[model samples]
Target: MSYPFGCIVVGSGHAGCCAALSAVEAGCQRVLVVEKGPKEWAGGNGYFTAGAHRTVHGGLRDLLPIVQNVTPAAVATIDMEPYSSEAFTTDIMRLGGGKSDPEMVSAVVGGSRDAVKWLAEWVHVPFILSFNRQAYLVNGRQKFWGGMVLSVEGGGKGLIAAHQQALEREGVDVWYETPAVELILEDGHVTGVVVLRNGQRIWLRASAVILACGGFESSPELRAKHLGSDWSRAKVRGTPYNTGDGLLLAQFAGAQLTGDFAHCHSTCWDANAPDDRGDRELSNQFTKSGYPLGLMLNAQGHRFVDEGEDFRNYTYAKFGREILHQPGGYAFQVWDSQTIKWLREEEYGDDVVKKIWANDVAQLADNLISEGLEDREAFINTIAAYNAAVQASQRERREVRWDPAIKDGLSTQSSQQFLALPKSNWALTLEQQPFLAVKVACGITFTFGGLAIDPETAGVISASSGEPIPGLFCAGELTGGIFFGNYPGGSGLTAGAVFGRKAGREAAKLAEDIYN
Candidate 1:
């Protein structure tokens, strides 16, 4: 059966759902969403997140409306810092190495709060303060830091459910297991989509089409081609369905591909994770991000990157690539009793494998050798040197400044004398008993490269003309130029919502003008 529509959105992830809903609201009577995966796996990478969203907010009061957990009593005990548009813009530009499109960055940062508010007010999605990940207790007061303040109730899966509910409420029809194979371009503009649904190919005509499918993070071939030869060794953190379908579809329709092809959003994940894209049960548990509190060593028992280079959020994305580039694509995050509690709750889960523990550092070193630690003495000596530096820093009165809420100056000095890679902050003495080490591998979230689009309208830009295609558009990870080498925490969801809404609305207007 063939059904013509005014607007057709490929991929039912956060971006596609938002686009479909916004298109219906913008007077597109027959807006439809086509997802490659089944209904159970609908949300894409957004489903695997902690659901944190970075936005410009006045403070706790401004967030109270959307955050269900915030109460008057809870507000007084926490320091909810305001994240302004300027700060958001700065973080995006700085983390992206100033390589991101300034106009898209401005649109994302300026519209972040409104996007979150739209999710709550218009889309009816519920959010709450991300207390577990973004806050720390100081003198009996919980202080929120790191610029992230809110998350959907059950995290990313909850967010997808919310979007599904909103789509159902708005009467937006969604076709599961329907993959858009190609875009039908006519007169130099996108006019329809050829989709593979239920073992049959159908050409669905539309006035406008929005490519919100996602990036090429799950494609091993593409990863090896663009993200270096070692990239295929990295674990896929999200949906395997996102294999560059959107990028290929858009490029075939004359869209300009932009952004950093060699870089992607990655993190330290469990080395034992399956080769395919991980599921919801594993969720964010694949991450082992407590390295700032301790240390990360390669297979040789030698540290490779600076573990405490910055807050985990600021550095986790890039460090995973470092791990992948390491010999055998493996690393271990080691911690002691002193910093064990500082680890995220995900680390202790049953899903994590190759967790080694011992009463002291020497036993820990011996146990690690079986797991591919080539040099036992080198590992022990490295720990000893790191401990000595921590003790020296403690003697210098840096102990009083030892606070985890912010970057305390608790760093190492002598470790630099003995080791190539040294801890830069939170260099606590690993002198405590029962040292713990967990196996880690590189987990790629999404690629930072895709089709370029206009920031104002979310319309795909033609490579030849350098102008927007009449009815072609994109959002989410499919639209590049907003992120490059690195990404700010929680900005992915915000970008999807902001640009998704814009693409949907613009596509609807185009459909009304051209097809009506």
Candidate 2:
């Protein structure tokens, strides 16, 4: 039986889910959610996320005062204190290399606190509380990525399930295992969707359509064609379902696209190689031995950017650069037995950090030699020189670490903490045995660039004239330029939620007001 709906939301990920929820809440009587995968594989980027959700006001607004009082020296304080909105904005702009749009950034920053509060109060999600009895904010003031997940209890699964239940409660129809093959357009407005269900093409009618499909990290051709060659070389860490189908469909319908040059979390595992099992084995090695925990070198044995910066900077640093030119694009973590012991103790309970291998310098060297990933003598010599530099710098009170160039070719902070160790002590030293070197190939989770949209309503805009396409909307990674070059914490999910809600509510209003 064919079905008609007031609105059709493609992709049941965080964006689509939020859009449906908002539509139902806004008094839409008929809404359908079409998801490509089954319930077991429902989550898009929201599932694998580290769960950091940063917002500027509302529940997270209390962090603004703390960030305001922090000095440059205090930025290094690792008490996991809350940060301020101004400081968070500054960091986001810096990370984006000042290419961010002020209006969009301000909108995200301004809406963040309210969004988090809504998620907790209305959505029944439980936010992580701070030691001082407030919601846990990153650096003490801003919301962390995983905060939303903690608020929901069962993490991404819980959040998704809750939304699904809400949709069902509102009588929203959800079609699982139904992938939208194309957008049905009539007279230049989206009329419905042509989906593949049970090996049959089903034409689902809707007054309006919302595209919440994710980015194209899973498609090498899209990456090579849309993004530059450097981004194409990186590995994918997100879901394999994002093959640019929604993007292609929208573009085919004459929708304008933007933000083809943005990406997030460039660090990836060499899971492409048959020899590598996954990130787990490598993580276990890193935790046990404390190796491969410092600055990365290219294949040529020279240090790249500062290893202590966020992984985003590290990923951009390696793009198009010769791995050999920068210390072979992979380097060893040289630490003594004390450091190794400390790391094991510190990271013992954490599953995320347990992937690192902690080993003495010499032992690490031998491990690499045995693995045939490096030459024994050169590896040893490199560690020795690194140790010498670290020692000399410590004595002279000078920064001796190698800092990689980030976007716009600016060097990151020289002194940053990593592996729960001070930057200075984290430097390579030759005195330690079991020196560890793990070959790391640059990896990326997802590309952030996609179609441009109106900041106020999440309506797709014409790339050539910057005008809105009525009756058409986009959310999630499909809507680009929202994050600029770098993303504000939780902007991905937050944008999806905020904009998806707007699109759904607005689309429903437009549908209800349509003249016969």
Candidate 3:
């Protein structure tokens, strides 16, 4: 079977939607976006996000265009620090362990603010302050922490909906339940894609093809093959449709794969959450990210990773992998009544959640005795020591004020007194009873590994040859080298918009040059 379009984009997530919309803006009359998932589940992992986009902003004035309901008085009460392009790029390079491609990092970081502006001004995607994840209250005034500030009004679903509306407004054709299976190359250049649509194999010929599909985190076989055998137990946090189709398709096109294949963007999710993606009611509840406010203990009642090493946005992605490495692939996020108000409402209010609480740390340990908890004495002693250390650290730093908006330098000082892993920041005393615990497990978001593409144009480059594949572009999670094991929160959405728009415009130009 055969069909024709001016430009064809694989997948219908944020990347594909942006690619299709931009293609139309670049003079493509007929742009087709193909997705394997059904209409309700078309947006891929992007629809499952918090709608946050990490971008470089020059304080309150720079963010005013996107952030809704921002008054001069409200802005005056908050501290809006500038996140510069250099700082953005440096953060990526640093967090990625210096393995991020400098060129790709530069392109994404340099274009992020403009890309976000485009989304708000041109696409009309409503943006709001990320009060839950990126900001903290200090002195009765809201202060933004981390480099991120804005998110779509309704998060991932809202972001996808806005992009979908824009695509529809541009008259871009969308083919749902059509999964791109193969790339047809002629004279070493991409000409079209072969996809499965309605149980029929159809060859959709186009002047250009943009692969905006995702990575292979959903496939256990691929996870074991690339990310090590331990990833086999990793529960998927998004759609089950992202089974490495895009990565495999790009690889078959001779694209060089890069980034940390053995690592992914993972997080602590409800341990009893479904193996597949959660529904709208669950939303981002699959996440249990407020661990920094309290404690995380393994089955043996021991702290492993540094919960307060940094902000949750900076550390949440990699911590799930650590939880998966623990015995029985489970950990519990423990907190007290005093810090419970700070927990993200999405997580604490989850219907599937089972809260375990007790009056004391020892009683809390006993509550989990039936769930393979062993060391009651150790658990009691650990909390007692942690509490004492917090009191001591507060006294030692008597001149230093405690602030939740930033790293207050208030840490548990007893880690040196014992051999347990230390809480490096925001270590408040867990003495305020009753104690609480929420069982959590590893939930994988997306794989960090993908094909390499041209930094400026988002054109896929051939591995065998050091040249771009003509009429071939790539973006979103399918493009590699920008992220390693760790990524700054909200940057994924920004990357999708920046590179997806670039790929669309470049592919449209290529199509015009060839077929016009």
Candidate 4:
């Protein structure tokens, strides 16, 4: 039998794009990419991301070569700290609660820098230093924080466009509206894929198959089945087409599932966003990440999470569950004029969401009642008590040095006495006039569990024999054992590229070995 293609890639997200290109570079002459969505919905969940990628770097000098937007003057004004491979691994493990696989974490960390460089040079992705999102002008210098400092010029849209251009240049065939229905197995080894195209089931033979489709976050049924019933109601923050096709296909081929199925990468999103789908235009703008700069309170006028706990990306993923667990499945983020101007315009601009403003504490609480504050008295009392605690903490600290780029020791509770829950970082008292607030709800990004794969080759592991399913590779969100309960921000895309590159190169080798 003559095989039509050397390798077939399922899914057309960033991971799949990376895999396809790698396969082509590895000598795969006939490679095809299958995308479940139509041409308009091509990039999968990656289309709705902020396009930030986390990678290890030797400070600014090392990163200057890959980034396209930074100038020499801007570089002198920027003060970025070096992120070591050890630091990256420790951060991932810490955020995952020490449940992340050491091997996978090591692979991602070791490969991240090169993966980012390849994306910038090979794919021509418009890379920029994350000055607006990650840095603050502290002491007349741009200080980048949280160990993440790179993003696409136009976020996900720009990233997808760059990948598309690269694919076109490489002469790869991308079939939109073609969904992979099942894996074609021969003697317990995947040989091809059965796809539904033009309302017909067509079998395409290939030497190797790589699955890079995303997780099951878009499927309410899978969310309820694997992540819990409450997740069924959570708003999807990305493409609605990611219904776990690759995950299901791998399972049907006897792939073993690993990682935490009950958890996901969720965030505080706009409470008013559409429940089932995400806006292609607004995209991640619905995310309410400014909670770290202010206070997040439930309907009953109580602080449920430490808004100042760690950096926003480090804690934002898990905070969505905290908001979902609150009464009525929603919460409100409040900030006074003291911190309102500092909120990121990309997320909290006037046209993005309805912003309620008030002049005083009582008026703010009264206005919030219309927005969902349960008790006016409780809201006022909570603000008063929080203000008092902030004053107390300031007095004990003796010096007030508030820096957004660093864990500015400024806090709301101190030695003499502290609240049951303390704001551990930038804790300016929210007493300034004209307070602002916005309603927020949980926005599910992607699930935490998927098919177990070899960290080196991205080959899916078989459930029956604890061995790789030959010629069946996996990447992206479908490949699990990387993340657990929580994930560090920007790590997902980097991990996807790292493993996708591996899967592509290995699949090309396997195909050459079989067909050449």
Give candidate 4's error at residue 369 in angstroms: 1.8
Runs of candidate 3 with Cα error greater than 4 angstroms are 350-352, 414-420
lDDT score, candidate 2, position 159? 61
Candidate 4 at residue 495, lDDT? 93
Q: Mind giving the per-residue lDDT tens digits that candidate 2 earns over 1-516?
A: 466688889888778887887777777768888888776666666665433455554333354332223355543432333445675567557656787666656666666666666655555444543221112234344322212212234445556665667777778888888999988877777778899999999998877789987878777777777655655555554556777877788887787876635454344233222221123223211211123234443333344444433423212323322331233233333345434433333223343331234355445555555333455566556545565555554555454433211112112213431222223323444465443334545444456677777778877775555677667788877776655444443456676677777788877886686623
RMSD of each: 1.7, 7.4, 1.6, 1.2
lDDT of 4 by residue, 1-516 (tens): 334788999999999999999999899879999999999998988888889999999999999998888887887888999999999999999988899989999999999999999998888999899887888887899999999999999999999999999999999999999999999999998999999889988899998899998999999999999988888889999988889888889989999999988899999999999998889899989999998789988999989998888988899999998898888889999999988888999999999999988999899888989888897898888878888898999999977688888898788888875789889999889988889999999999998899899998899999999999998998888878888888899999999999999999998898789776
Candidate 1 residue-wise lDDT, 1-516, digit = tens: 556798999988898888999998888878899999998888889999888888999988888888788778877898887888888888888988898999989999888998999999888788989877788777898878778888888888889999999989988889999999988877897889999988999999888899989999999999999998899888999898999999888878888999889899998888888777986786877777788888888877778888877777788898988899887899888988987876777656544556799998889888988887887888888788877776775676644576777777677754334245667777788878888999889999989988888999999999999999887889998878888888878889999999999999998898888775
lDDT by residue (145-256, candidate 3, tens digit) is 9788888888888888888888878888788888899999888888899998878888888988998889888898999899888888888998888889887788788887
Candidate 2 ranges with C-alpha deviation above 4 Å: 57-84, 129-155, 228-233, 262-265, 268-293, 298-301, 309-359, 370-372, 398-439, 463-465, 484-489
Listed in order, each prediction's TM-score against the native is: 0.97, 0.75, 0.97, 0.98
> Which residue pairs show backbone clashes in model 3?
none
Clashes of each: 0, 69, 0, 0
Question: Least lDDT summed over 10 consecutive residues: which range in candidate 3?
Answer: 412-421
User: Would you list the C-alpha lDDT of every candidate in the order shown?
Assistant: 0.85, 0.56, 0.85, 0.90
lDDT against true structure, model 1: 0.85
